[model samples]
Target: MSKIYVLDTNVLLQDPHSIFSFEENEVVIPAVVLEEVDSKKRYMDEIGRNARHVSRLIDSFRGNGKLHERIPLENGGSLRIELNHRSFQQLQDIFIEKTNDNRILAVAKNLSLEEETKEDGKTVILVSKDALVRVKADAIGLLSEDYLSDRVIENDHVYTGFLEVYTAKETIDRYYEKGEIQASEIVTFPLFPNQFLVMKDALGSSASAIGIVDKSRKKLKKLIFDYDHIWGIKPRNVQQTAAFELLLRKDLPLVTLTGKAGTGKTLLALASGLLQTEDHGAYKKLLVARPIVPVGKDIGFLPGEKEEKLRPWMQPIYDNLEYLFNVKKPGELDAILAGMGSIEVEALTYIRGRSIPDQYIIIDEAQNLTKHEVKTILTRVGEGSKIVLMGDPEQIDHPYLDAYNNGLTYVVERFKDQMIAGHVKLIKGERSGLAQLAADLL
Candidate 1:
């Protein structure tokens, strides 16, 4: 049975060409959706860029046939604007104001009624990115679904790089005595190379050590813990330990980490970069940059050079640095940042057209990056360079990106099976007690 998929404005804003995703079925764009798109088309940021893209997409279809009328799509679906479904009479009876949500719901309800009246009884489903819209659709007895057009990973089983194996302590002891052990010998569980193993005695004993081995049974050396324990930045669980393994892997040219805020994604990356660059001399320099996607609140523009303009967005990166370096005075960290031009901090805009070699590149807030933008950044890696992408998918500020299709998640999903690339999803909160609580509650 051909189903009618009603698209919300968010789906269009997220991906301008989203209408083409549904094949061999009817795609209905509620009239209110256009109004919402029009309202967002005048800005100069990502949202406005997407709105204009949506406008251009809708305009392009007019050349094929009249979009306001039922037109056949190339993929065997019919595209049409819902003209007869703009019934505000039912909504105005309940609320005096004509809210956008109610208008959208009214359009969906009218479409559902029209489908029910048809003899074939085809289904009408409302597609939206809003949770409340789905609830409202359910209230009106309409089939509703989240616009999961870009989800990469299935469910929430994100990449956690730690594997726990329960074996005889003698098995681990024999491996240490022999200087190596075959991965197949650990029969209790499967293992991924470069993955840290937390071996516990199957006999209910408490023996565990973090170690990494390769397919050739060669063990990589571990870094020494020489600093004060990061109290608010402890790994909450094994997932974070797995995240640390990826963060510390110098052989992996590309690394991606995703999780919620206060999950220690940024802190762990910064800590590992510092250890590898300053202490271990693994990489020549540490180059950290984040896409300057403004949060819900903007602090206005700064008047000065590029560094001054970047201060606001780069402050979080600096905060992690200041804490890691234990700078007591105000200008102490700045002096250090100035002295070691080894640490290059710049905006993503300036990183284009420059090849970075023999350095550790960390791009924070990568979830806000576009697919094209991410490709541009990744291609700039020179020989002996490692790039790490980290961000929170749930807190995206870019209008055209989503949890599934955002550049960060896109890179992680596309390169997951590759040996030189690794990904870790940090699930624990280690920023602070209140921040963790807010992260969990909010």
Candidate 2:
């Protein structure tokens, strides 16, 4: 049955081409939605970019036909601008205020209640990225849905990159004894490149050294760095080892690591980045960045230059760098930073419109970012650049976000198929005993 879908501003902001997402369904853009999109189009962030894109998309569609009137889409659907909605009248009867949200709800309600479009009593459905707007639409007897066009992975189907397979005890023994085996001779059913196998002896014997082998059964080389002793830092766990592969792989331009606190996600990424950019000549510089998420009610003002103002948000990255450098004094690390001139700590706020190539980019605390924000950062990566996104999804602070919906998880889910991307869910915490216990218990 043909139904009209009234789009909210957030849907367009979440995905600019959302109009084309609903296959064969009529798309209706209330005049109020344009007002909202117009307000956000001038901002200098991802939302603004998407808003402008949506405006341009609508303008392009004008060449097809008048948007104010129904126009046939290439797909078996049509697009139209709904300018006759009387949401203002309905909302005035209840709230008596012409609020933007109320006006949008009224548009949806009017369309949904229109008798001419009703089919078995279902006329229209509203799509939005804003939860409040969906709730308001439902309250006014309008069908509503969240705009999930940007969601890359379905619930419970995200790639883990590891598989549990039952293998013969004799094969496990031979693998350890020979230190290498033929891939075809092995009975492991599923194996991915660089994937680790526990190889538990079915008969129960202490036989295990983490190994990754190629299809030819040859042991693949582990990640090695040229800087043997520039700094005494070492990877403390398997998660860090896997992270090193993602951070150093020139072929893999995108990497995402998710785990709880004390999982060594940030430390390993930062350490490997320092090794490649500072110690080795792999890249020209190391760029470390994180989104600025206010812990509580925002103070709304800070006085200083970019670095000083960014200090409050970027202090955690600085702390990890200080620990890696083993500096004793407060300003000692700053002096080292100045001397290296190869390591940079900046906020995501200023990363837009910059071309970053031949650098190891680490984006910490990535769980607070949206899908749009993540896309913006990934698109800015030029050739010969590796971008690593690390964050604890459970520790997300964005109000409109959750563990499953944040940018880090979205990236992991979307780019799973690309050979150039790898994802790791750090299970163990190697930070400290207390930190580990706290992470587990809390």
Which candidate's TM-score is highest? Answer: 2
Q: Give the per-residue lDDT digits (tens) of candidate 1, residues 1-442.
A: 9998989998887777778888899999988899999999998655678799989878878887877788888888888888788877766765456788788888887778877888997788988988888987787687999877666665765555556677788877776666556666665445545555667788887765555645343442232232333433555576676666677766788888888898888888888887788878899999999988787887787899877888888999999889888889998998998887778888998887898899989999999987768888999999999999999888898765667778888887777656787777777787789998998999
Off by over 4 Å in 1: 39-44, 187-193, 213-245, 258-264, 275-284, 294-296, 352-354, 368-373, 393-407, 425-442
lDDT of 2 at 289: 96
By TM-score, how accurate is candidate 2?
A: 0.84
lDDT of each: 0.78, 0.77
Candidate 1 lowest-lDDT run of ten: 220-229
Model 1 TM-score on a 0 to 1 scale: 0.82
lDDT of 2 at 439: 90
In model 2, what lDDT does residue 441 have? 89
**Which runs of model 2 end up more than 4 angstroms from their true locations?**
88-97, 116-122, 164-166, 182-191, 213-237, 245-254, 352-358, 368-385, 397-407, 432-442
